[model samples]
Target chain A: MAIEVRVPTILRSYTGGAKVVEGSGDTLSGLIDDLDAKHNGLKGRLITPEGGLHRFVNIYLNDEDVRFLGALDAKVADGDSITILPAVAGGALGFAAAAALLGR
Target chain B: MTPGVPAVGTATPGRAKSHGNVRHVLTIDSAILDAIVAHARRDHPDEACGVVAGPAGSDLPTRLIPMDNAARSMTFYEFDSIEQLRVWREMDDNDEEPVIIYHSHTATEAYPSRTDISFAGEPGAHYLLVSTREPDSTEIRSFRIVDNVVTEEEVNIVDATVDA
Candidate 1:
């Protein structure tokens, strides 16, 4: 069975506003490649020519971080759930909050 | 997939609570943010975000705090504070300041969204943005906030990791 891919609200436009997608693969990276093949715009939006995960974009496999794992090469299984996340910043006290995150 | 898909929630809101010692400032260098932006861009098929730590004083040493990218493709990041604690220890051991929280915008420009501004927690910290809308465009920008004021800074892309 193919695993289901979920797109977050911000990236809905790339997927034609569909929050969920379907694909077949044994690893997270494989599944994304398959999806990208079907969606060129998604490929442009997601992948850089260097083949590394986008800094602004984040990926999760069953709630575990792919970066700590094997990155895009991380393996997946049937019925696995994939999610795409992008990092954003901006607010009134946004600058203060961002500073708080910076530590010593 | 929590970690499989790069989501918005995982963008580490890199904030370090004020230790109240001489009102010191925390920070992460442009090189570190460059590394993060590069990583996100490289992984554009997915989203990427994380925490970069170090110490503040006359001198600073930047450290990478590998946390969760929780936004799930929503152009945001919610870093794991628990994981951040561990990174804090590492910086403590090395005497550095964790001064930066950064994220990127795939297929968009490197500018702050309403949410990005509203979620600002730490004051005087650098807010780094990485955008990948244009293939040949330099999609990275930095910001600083204090007392509800936002200030943008020039990010220095040193090298691949340095540039990120």
Candidate 2:
């Protein structure tokens, strides 16, 4: 299945400045792997060595946060849109707090 | 909707100076601004969080909503999930959207941090930051965050009319 992914501006470098790209996978994790194959080092920026999503990265499936759904294991299908964004906050807030502020 | 402000993407580049310029201006009623400042001061040393809602797609902020800071830390703030969900649902039911998302910084300047830029999901909403570091003065700033690009904007505080 072809799933369209939206790349945030900060990570556009890995995608050669392409804002959106298509990848195939059955789960969110698989999708990342698929994209990483084409865009080297992309996965490293999103996922940590511990096999968990990086604290500073947030992945949203169809506008719903994957962390609230199933994280990297969240199911995906054709036409799904996955958005990757780094965890950012206004001022002193951290990743978790920033995510919470956005009501994710 | 703003009474005299033009909707974004509808304004012609050069013909509508007000429309073009207003895009970077956050117009808030003085009373509401004071309330937000009060909330920030009341939560001194801890971050205060809340939102201002207006008619959906209007780009006008008319309602003040003070949310509980679930994090309640001096350096961080988070809206209570359950409360956020309910508030969002209510806004949807009322055909309203969050036009302004605001929070306070207890010890820092009024600007978005890297984390804030990463977490900005609403391209149309204005992110307002209020710093309560100084006991005598509050520093407030507004910005538009789209795709992680943060652009500082001007804040125009309007006098609250009798009808308002």
Candidate 3:
């Protein structure tokens, strides 16, 4: 069985509105890469150019935060569920626009 | 509205059983409300964020913790990862939970933004927004954010101390 990855509403556009997608890999990074192969640009949004998870993006594996579980190096197996969410705080769109412009 | 969509006070499917099947109206202490407002005011222009922790299984918000917005930007807020880890660990040690996850909108009204709805990860916590847009008064509102759906709820500011 492939791992099930849950996509957040904000990033659903990249996945063609498919909430949950299946990918396979031995580790979290491998799974993300496998997903990106099918859904272009997804990995870029979740990972930084420096080869680390994006500061604003959080990836949870089976309700356990990946940060505390070795981040992208965390091991994965069949039937594991992954959840990706953007770190959000403060006001709504108005602030979001400003933050985007500020490159935050 | 969708024909079968649950109303504001109705419990959404998959809501944690510990919170019961119905959505309970959140009642916060007047002092706590004041403190949240004060924090927002103090951070004016920049959005302020924090959580009110309560005893585990109690659902009563009593401790007001004003956290630093790591982004420190007027438009965005991010809990410093290190600080978040420390606070969450402390809460676990104390057998507490973040009953209320709150933030301020320095310019917008007291409503969840699209981003807010998208980023709400705490399914069991009361998502509170305080609007400090007006100089004379602050507007505060509460909602339950589950599965990207935002449902506004009543905020009952009680006068007496919450039972421990």
Candidate 4:
């Protein structure tokens, strides 16, 4: 059995709108590379140019966050499932409009 | 009203064609809105964040899940990664989607800041903003942030009902 990867809406375009795709690898990084071979550009969205997981992306292996594990080095099994979600974040500061509103 | 997210009463279940074009006006329960405002007040001076989950493709927010701001800063708000994972999984198991992703501004108005626009990833979810800047009255607004573009939407608060 191949590893199953779940794609979130933002990155579905690379998967041809497929929510789940299959690939084979022994490690998380390898799995990503295998998937990228077919999806192309999917790796770049999940991994930064520095070869680390993107800060704005969250990858969970089964029910565990890979970040808390070994991240790219995390182990992957044939039946494992990977879920990729875009980080939900934001703020009200660090902007010219906000700074002006603050009278700064 | 946009094609994907037409005005209220025009959307049908299981017809959510696209994320960014999901909904136009937010028809929310008043009690839920009050709870969100209260959460913002309680977390004043620090940005509060949460999500409202609804049935998949329903665009109706029925479950409110308040999240811990990992940043815990007055200017920034981020969902705790672990918490986000758990909540998202729960939503997934329940076949629900994040209908409303809400956050608070301690000092600024109830609007999407440039930072907010930059980080908006859920094109289908309504971005709800609550400003607790003024202690006497709170300002709340809704917006659709898709592709770095922000469009303000109307907020229609209605009483909670058993059928809703």
TM-score of each: 0.44, 0.63, 0.64, 0.85
Model 3, residue A36: distance off in Å is: 15
lDDT over C-alpha atoms for residue A84 of model 3: 74
Chain B TM-score by candidate, in order shown: 0.64, 0.86, 0.85, 0.86
Off by over 4 Å in 4: A95-104, B1-22, B161-164
Question: Candidates sorted by DockQ, descending order?
Answer: 4, 3, 2, 1
**Model 1 RMSD vs true structure:** 17.4
TM-score of 2: 0.63
Give the alpha carbon lDDT tens digit for every residue of B86-148 in model 3.
676577789887889999988888898877775676677899999999999999999998877
What are the C-alpha RMSDs, in order, of all predicted structures?
17.4, 7.0, 8.3, 6.2
The fnat of each candidate, in order, is 0.21, 0.40, 0.45, 0.68
Error of 2 at B81 (Å): 2.3
TM-score of chain A of each: 0.76, 0.84, 0.84, 0.87
Interface RMSD of each: 10.6, 5.5, 5.2, 2.5
Q: Candidate 1 on B1-164: residue-level lDDT in tens?
A: 67655433343333322121112332335466556757776756344666565455422325665455643444445665335444544655776555666666776677776557655554535666777767776576777655446667644432332333
| Cα displacement (Å) at residue A9, model 4 | 1.5
Per-residue lDDT of candidate 2, residues A1-104 (tens digit): 58998785567888998978999999989999999999999999888897987756567787677888899999999989887754433448675655565553
Q: Where in model 3 is the C-alpha error above 4 Å?
A: A1-90, A94-104, B1-24
What lDDT is obtained when candidate 3 is compared to the true structure?
Answer: 0.79
Error of model 4, residue B141, in angstroms = 0.9
Return whichever of 2 and 4 wins on TM-score: 4
> Measured against the native two-chain assembly using Cα atoms, what DockQ does each of the candidate structures obtain, in the order listed?
0.09, 0.23, 0.27, 0.50
Candidate 2 lDDT tens digits, B28-64: 8789899999999998888888899988766778889
Where does candidate 2 stray beyond 4 Å? Answer: A1-90, A93-104, B1-21
